[model samples]
Target: MLEIKDVAFGGKAVGRLEDGRVCFSPDALPGERVQVTVTRETKRFVEAQLDRVLEASPRRVKPPCPYYGACGGCSYQHAAYDYQVELKTKQVGDVLGRLGGIENPNVLEGVPSPLPYGYRNRITVHRHGGRIGFHRRDGKGLVDIEACLLASDEVNKRLAELRRERFHEGARVLREHASRMGFHQTNDGVGALLQDAVSEACGSGGCLIDAYCGDGFFAHRLAKKFQRVIGLEWNERSIAQARSVAHANESYIEGDVAARLAEVLEEADGAATTVILDPPSQGLDVQVADLLRAYPVAKIVYVSCNPATLARDLKSLAAVYELGSATPFDMFPQTAEVEVLAILRRRF
Candidate 1:
């Protein structure tokens, strides 16, 4: 038996074996004693499979979904909604402090989803042989699911329709929300809160440079706050969509952000500029960091889905910028995935 002390960033509860080796188990919670069998072992840590809950936590609750343990889609169904948010909030702070090398990072409480279950606007299911559903929790094969508890009603209805039809061995994406533009957030409720945070961070700037501005998600909404708004992205399709609803003050360029950012930064006044970075899961490129350091902006609002990469990028910019606030958005509620908005200001 091991006492689970904390939940790690990647959705595993951390505990220590009798020999002092760190162990990770997915179906366990903090403050609980669990009996586990080691599945994989490394020099640094051990991965274990939870066999039984020796001492259950108060936060543990009956999972509503019948396929909760079998399906790989959701992890926190057995945990209370508020406790899930609390665990994720701590996970963000832990990752930032450990990986980013920031002492006592300013991490705010996680913003809870309006509806924990039935919040997902879309769900992707795979079909293999006779099974048609998501991958198993162990990831060895598919687990046939009648319906997904995390998916919205409309998405579930489409899923039901897909179940009746026969398809080749592949994946099917059922979505309720429609976006003509590219790369919109999956959770619409939390997505609006995310935009609000970004807008607040970009308060009253003269020039706004939105890097990796897919479909001008922020650029279009925040054009009125700045005298000039420039959006940089590589996707031509997204740029076209952004251009279709272009504000008078907004100008979008279709090119690599690292290649074109310097040219725009050279012309904009550094004191009056606020650059918004909504990079991919890998975070900002090294060249992009170098350019930002060379040409410092007044403020930066970085939006990231992966906390580890976000921490690394924040550390890279620590020399020129000071951390203002870090807010966690529970965009993907049931899973361990978290979205963070980090605000930074040029150091005096």
Candidate 2:
């Protein structure tokens, strides 16, 4: 018997097995009593597959998608959308306290996305065994899907066209961007809220140095608010596009920000600046944090998707900067993914 006490960060239920070993059961909800079959086991913990829910929580609901359990697309489909946000908010606070060594950090409730369903602007589907669809929960095999509920209507129509066009490649990618299919927010509606949150965190002033800035999304808007804006990205195509629309005060540089950050800071010449970091899911290196520590940058507005690495980075940065409240945004609903925006002001 397993008593699911709470839900973990990756959409698994935190529970203890009969042998007192901590067990995680996938596709589970908190407050549920269940019998599980152990799939994998370690010395400290065990991973189990859900067998049967002897007692279900009131918040547990029937999943909307037919392939909810099989397809790796949606993890929280069995959870109510409001409950999903609540779990994510709690998870963010837990990580901040446990990993970041922050005692009772100011963490606000997660902001829900404007459109939860049908919000993804891009997706890459796999083609295997005559099935053109997504990967399974284990991320090994393909799950044949007729349609994806998370994709936009335009993307779904394109999926249908791809099926009819005999485009039976190993994978099919869907993108909303006109120029090139690169990295952009899958949920653009919530992305606006993220931009607003970052802007609010920075509070309108100083040089906006947008690291990993793609197509000048944040830098262009902040150029008017600041004396100058510098966007650094490795993508040459995105840099070209950004340069084409650059204002007189805005400049986009095509290079690795990490290598050129010190040079850029030297050029800034001790001006008040906010270094905006929107890194990938892998977070950033300790060297980046070290540079921020040595530099005189006034503020840092960090946008992150992975909390574990975010906590690690914040812990390192805490020695130099004063940590502020962390705000989470539900950029991807019905999934384990959560977007977090954290602000750190320089300590005197």
Candidate 3:
């Protein structure tokens, strides 16, 4: 028996064994006394599965999604939405304080999604038998589903269409609404809020250079605030879309940000320029970090989906930059993924 003390970053909770060994138990909540079966053991800590919850937390709730526990998509559906936000905020502060080496970081309260359910604009469904749905939590098979509770109505309609018409065995299909197509934010409501947060912190600068600027999202939003706005992305399709509606003040470049960062920064003319970097889950490239060290951009607004990668990048940037604030946005409810925006200003 162990007492779960806190919520971890992933789908796990903190606990301690009788001998004072740190234990991480899954499918349990904080303040719960759980009987755990040890699944994995390391010198530093032990991993476990919740055999039974002898005591449950007040924050625990019945998951709304029928496929909550079986489907591989969601993790925190068992917890209340407000508790989910609190857990995420604490996780962000913990990661920054320990891994990022930022002591007593200014971590603000997490911003919750306007609509916790039916907000996802995209979902990947796999063919199971004659039907299409998500994979099982164990990854052994697929779970047939009629409609996902996390997708938008438009997306659900598209999913219905996809269910009626499809081909190939074990084929994975991405069904999306015709209007919101291809690699856009899944939670537009939360995205709009995140964009506003970034824009408010972006302060007045000579220019803005957007890196990993998918479809010129932030670039187009803050174009009016800067004299010049240039966005760099690796995807040709995204770049094409960005250029299709490019304004007189905006320029979209097709190339890796690390390879083309110098060219984009040249337009800044060594003045006060804000560099906006929204990298992928893998975080920044080594080339990008080295270049930033060499060039030392005056200001940076970094948006990331993976806290581990974000912490790693921030640790490197701390040498020449002063971290302002780190804010977490509960972009995805019932899931472990968290979106964070970090503000930085150069020390020199």
lDDT per residue as tens, model 1, 21-140: 999998799999999999999988999989999899998999888888788888888789999999999999999999998899999888998888888888888999898899988888
The lowest-lDDT stretch of 10 consecutive residues in candidate 2 is 174-183
Cα lDDT listed for each candidate: 0.90, 0.85, 0.85
Q: Over 4 Å off in model 2, which ranges?
A: 269-271
- Model 2 Cα lDDT, one tens digit per residue, 1-348: 788998989899889876788999887888889989999999989999999999998998898888888998888988888999999999999998899898997888899998879998888888888888998998778998778999888888877877777765598787766456446778999999998888777766668889888888778878788888998899988888889889999988888877878778877744488889998888877667788888868888899999888888889988888778789999999989999998888877
lDDT of 3 by residue, 117-207 (tens): 9988788777857657888877778888889998888778877887777566665545454543435777999999998988888876587
Sorted on TM-score, best first, the list reads 1, 2, 3
Q: Local error of candidate 1 at 143, Å?
A: 1.7
Q: How many residue pairs clash in each candidate?
A: 0, 0, 0
- Give TM-scores for every candidate, taking all chains together and pairing residue i with residue i: 0.96, 0.96, 0.95
Assess candidate 1 and give its lDDT. Answer: 0.90
Error of 3 at 82 (Å): 0.7
Cα deviation at 264, candidate 3, in Å, is 2.2
